[model samples]
Target: MLSLLTDQQALPEPVGPLTMFGPDFPFAYDDWLAHPAGLGRLPEHVLGTEVAVIGGGLSGLVTAHELMKLGLRPVVYEADQLGGRMRSASFEGHPGTVAEMGAMRFPPSATALGHYLDLLGLSTAPFPNPLSPLTPGTVVDLNGESHWARTSAELPTAYREVADAWEKALHEHAELSMMNAAIRRRDVAGIKAIWNRLVPKLDDVSFYGFLSSSPSFASFRHREIFGQVGFGTGGWDTDFPNSMLEILRVVYTGADDDHQRILGGCQQLPLGLWDYSPGRMAHWPEGTSLASLHDGGHRPAVTAIDRVGTGFLVHDKEGVAREYPAAVFAAQNWMLLSKIRCSESLLPGPVWTAVERTHYMGSSKLFVLTDRPFWRDIDPATGRELMSMTLTDRMPRGVYLFDDGPDEPGVMCLSYTWNDDSLKFAALPADERLEVVLGSLAAIYPGVDIRSHVIAPPVTITWENEPYFMGAFKANLPGHYRYQRRLYTHFKQDGHASGHRGFFLAGDDISWTAGFAEGAVTTALNAVWGVLTHLGGTTAAGNPGPGDVFDQIAPVELPED
Candidate 1:
């Protein structure tokens, strides 16, 4: 493995170099170059088939798997490697251990997740919990003094007034949920009522704006906590605006799972699928040349489709084309937009703009290997563990530690979310960013002297720079409520000339819990239901309604609206 830092001399040497080969390498640039003659490297002819699914991420794979069970042999056209963002990195020193750089854990509420696991014949294990007595808390550097910041407690005395104002806002928009239900059922009057209420709010006013301008509003200190807990910030002036009720709805209604980290890592899920499918599954190399489609009726159609379709052509970066009766576009929304050449524009201007421009959080993980469980010493005064000292703002937010050490051995993975432009880091010499990350680690854990005890070089996965995945996961900006609606409505198979018939959209983007494993699973289940409907199959078989698997799990009650 290439040493990211120049101070390698200061650190212990590794046994071997790190290799970056994986099933998930980006395939856009190379796959487009390997098309067969007379095919234009794109799907030129329209072929009739049962189904063709494009993009091989979780969404696409799950959809195809569901279709097969429904008696349809769906062809999956994946551009790069399978598993999409769920790529794992190999470290030389850790023989059996793998570091996951994408899609870490799944929530229990996602029935599809459990079903998919069973289908793959994989079992679940509780996420590693060493039970260190450290209570995780956010600390802010205030005038060089580290002060604990608790969102709800840190609010000023006047916060209640702001909360009251937010309550009133909720009452005024009390009919919003009804409007949403109406839109879901395609009720014209209901949709009209919603548009009437929402249009006035869209004029120069953002969600943040409404919150701040409200008589009861205050600072974002406490508001941010709500946001972190999946609640919308009650700030009116913020670009990502929503009623306080909507915020509460997210907090109360979203899926919850105490389990973290799959037993062998997330790769087990896909590996199980491959094992189950065996000869039926194929892992194509990037840039493989595709066969030509001669008859328009028999030929596959290459178009960016959100809905699952009967027949389509998929052209990979290698110029290889595969004709399938149905295709699932399972990659990120923006990435799919670039690959499929739609005959007519399905996504409208504003909706497409939101999909392409919505800022997503960037994620990077730092894996540290130690000879033993060294951070066991707890600080009795603050109830914080020695490992907890490693939390700092200089790097990313939500940094977590895993026990990948020997005997009690485990991996300590720290995650960071980038707030600024990632292009700035990509522009810098690679060594510079490495130096910054190392410096931050040094600040967090001064005792171990990572420079000396390091077993392997740090592995970094920059979600922002990745070609197929432009960013880590979806995060709606202030005043972008319409974007969420658009994600659901604009991609449906609603008889639009540009829209795909039977082609369905699924992934973290379309579901309510955007940027989570549960969202991906939920979207996949939804897509499966659509596929079943098209095949004259019962929805009950494809979608085992809510409370089927999770009813046994205890309910978690959050602050009620």
Candidate 2:
């Protein structure tokens, strides 16, 4: 330990507020969207031209919605319901209390998503993450030992040690404070200079390795404890072994913590964009929205995408086909192989490898509506809620509480697990899964009576089991930095070797940062720029997108073999 009495000092403090987007591209698009000059408008000639958007999720919907504003028609295609991973299911009778089946939390710094939230007139409150400001208290159960605390200060010594070490690691080792300051100022040169230096060092390193190298976590015990109870975003055990870059992007961006959720559900953002009437529009009559163009409906799921002449032909699930001048694929990258019949010519070998190898992290959530905030009833001896927002080193990794009020029904996420933990329940039925979760919770809180108060059956989903979404979101693995570089830069130019111009790709997977909605919105915006540019439109001199200035501010692209 560096206990030098001669040069001694206290731990260094974090420099600035949180405002990062991803590992690279630190310039905030949230600031760009707020600028007086808007995203570039399409040239007059291409105003009414039709572009096909495959997928109706947040990415696809945002693509279509923005195209309308720039004077283009987007024919959206979807196989299932509109909100892909943003599904919100309400208890049969209690419409007021609903369960967020997917994408429950939103980070405050996700201003790209916030732009839509503000425009849609949606309201949000602090999400009740374990040990988060919104939660009155938190309960951490590890190795059959339960610790209850409102803050890390209130937890046991070991927990406090882990928390303090993480804070120091982020500030000194990860350079979180400096990067955050640059991002806040939208300092393109400064952010790139700092982030580019980090890429080579962190790219091939495992997140666990990154932590182990830090002075504060030199031993396995500290690293192990840190993984079991990561400060922000719950247990990071799943991502501990992933690429350090993945962990850096997550922790740096506000995605991992200080989150909020739409009052009703996060799905409303996409659903709201569907019918959103743009204050300004192009080529259409006075009032226009993605909904009005599609007659308030989306085309069937696209089964195949083949290049026809210079354009692309997309076939629906029923084999119904349509042709468009250009196409923006907004679905998960895996869909290109398993679900959609992709043309080999559409993507050359390298890009196809990037798409095929894009790793997705699986996730599962079990939700149940209770008669009331049953956990709120305090125990005289413990002086805490029956259970704190629970996080355990057990089968059910993280548990969240959504308290509507004491009078109204409250929803509790009995279990939210990721990766292999989620895969374990892939074969389990809803009832069986519920039993497994309740058993896990019962083990975590031995004396707590959680079952008798159940008001209705639980809602459970393992995203990996769902055919449409093979996994939760992209969790880039070690040495996959090149793949992300390839995926994100593919849309910037049309003249690739494959003669595959006008076929743009946009989604969370294609963004610099994966998993978060900010990435989804960023990629969608990139595709919009690609679409407009492909249709002979040019960005205004004042407003240039990431694609417009990709060269100077481009993140460190790993050298190809």
Winning candidate number (lDDT)? 2
TM-score of each: 0.64, 0.95
Cα misplacement distance, residue 432 of candidate 1 (Å): 4.2
Q: Residues 238-326, candidate 2, lDDT per residue (tens digit)?
A: 88768988877776665677688889888888999998888877778877888889888789988899998888999997778888988
Q: How close to the true structure is residue 37 of candidate 2, measured as C-alpha lDDT? A: 67
For model 2, how big is the CA root-mean-square deviation? 3.6
Q: Candidate 1 lDDT, tens digit per residue, 1-561? A: 000000012323422211110001111111111122110111113212346666566776666655544445556666556677777666666766667778765544344466567656666654422111222333332222344322334433333334444444443543433533442343444444544444334433545555556444455653442232221211122224433322322322222223445766686675445334422222222221111111111223234432324444555445556555444556677765565664333345656666676556665555555555455555566565555422233543334555543355445554444435234355444346556666665555555454444466566567777777777777665445556555544333433453344556678776545656655665665565555444444423323322122222212112212
Which parts of model 1 have CA positions greater than 4 angstroms off?
Answer: 1-50, 118-143, 147-249, 254-259, 277-311, 345-359, 377-384, 389-391, 404-409, 421-434, 444-448, 490-500, 535-561
TM value for model 2? 0.95
Candidate 1, which ten residues in sequence have the lowest lDDT sum? 20-29
Q: How many angstroms is residue 282 displaced in model 2 relative to the true structure, after the best TM-score fit? A: 0.8
